[model samples]
Target: MSDPWLMPDGKTKVDPFVEECRLDEIPFPVWFAPYTKGERLGDMLWTGGSGLKIASQRMIDALQDAKITGYRTFDVDVRDHAGNPIKGYVGFATDPGPTTDIQNILGQDGQNFVFIANQRVVEALRAHGADELDIRPYDPSEFD
Candidate 1:
């Protein structure tokens, strides 16, 4: 698959900041730059990849419980830079059927990060030189 990092024409990419995190070792703190129009928190940590994975599994479980007749669901979780709960995370199934085609476009990895925060916090982080954003489909499923 093509590298999402190089495709910026509104296509999503992983937050380099999250990838740089040491998921298995030390704590990872990421600052969210508050620039969007309508958000609450100022700074926040996009979920680590592992966090996303966990959330994905939960989403799948929820789908199963509801008897949703679609792609296999998944779950993931993430914390903010200050070790606070993340806005949300996302996941897609690996089933190679047309029903799961959209999931394929979400990235074969079946994982993504969605950060949420108030504009002020984002502004502060930008002022403080925070870089690498994991911007993508900032949906309620992941951010709400």
Candidate 2:
């Protein structure tokens, strides 16, 4: 993750913008930049350690239904390079995992702010067919 994340639009580059944010806060909608091509939004987005989490509208609903915490979400206005409204998406800012292996929440860790999801989060994503992420064991030393 040395280089910035190249978005699906092939135009937007998401760089690490925030080192951290309060769990109760919902930062401004994260786009980094607009997309030129008509690439659809993924259920889960690349955060680039921005501390802001972007998710599809459906994903948001799923999370809400699960009643998870440590984050807040808000509406996001996504648009094409031409400014056409891209709907059904939102952004959230969440708490860090405290450099531990969590088993019941959604959080980030380390330099890359890699997503560290608990089993419940994984199940929610899996149930919604939004499992486009890699599941890995947490190695505390990585962040040292």
Candidate 3:
């Protein structure tokens, strides 16, 4: 199969930042969890080349039942490549396939560090009866 990064004519499709930093070959995994006490406490939920495995329904149920709210999803910067902040959609694990597909594209490997602050996962948690959730933007500097 042809590489997504290559053009039909075989000239490399140059992503200035990606090429300069070799970001494409990195293995940065996706994460899901809440921000608490100015920290991101979560799990390495999925990885690229692994075909979109999301956290199970039982895990979500447990998080809700435990009253663990304030959830957001993001991925590690892996290489900390500057000026390439990743951007992507944020939604629940139970959201429809198309929604997840969009999110996957935005959060693809070797991109900037993507983050979804409030709203996304919190709404899902609220629907499951999480009452004390907070919505705050993730601070990338924390990783620095």
What C-alpha lDDT values do all the predictions have? 0.36, 0.53, 0.36
The best candidate in terms of TM-score: 2
Ranking by TM-score: 2, 1, 3
Q: For residues 14-91, could you state the per-residue lDDT of candidate 2 as single tens digits?
A: 443333432223233434323224365577565443545566777767767776554556555555556566677666
What lDDT, from 0 to 1, does candidate 2 have? 0.53
RMSD of 2: 8.6
Give the TM-score comparing model 2 with the true structure, all chains together: 0.57
TM-scores for the candidates: 0.26, 0.57, 0.24
Runs with alpha carbons beyond 4 Å of true place in candidate 3: 1-4, 14-113, 125-137
Tens-digit lDDT track of model 3 for 58-135? 435645565444332222332112333223322232222333312322333432323342344555555665443334
Supply the global lDDT for candidate 3.
0.36
Q: Name the lDDT value of residue 9 in candidate 1.
A: 42
Clashing pairs for model 3 are 86-112, 86-113
Q: Where is model 1 more than 4 Å wrong at Cα?
A: 1-62, 69-77, 86-95, 98-102, 106-144
Error of 3 at 96 (Å): 20
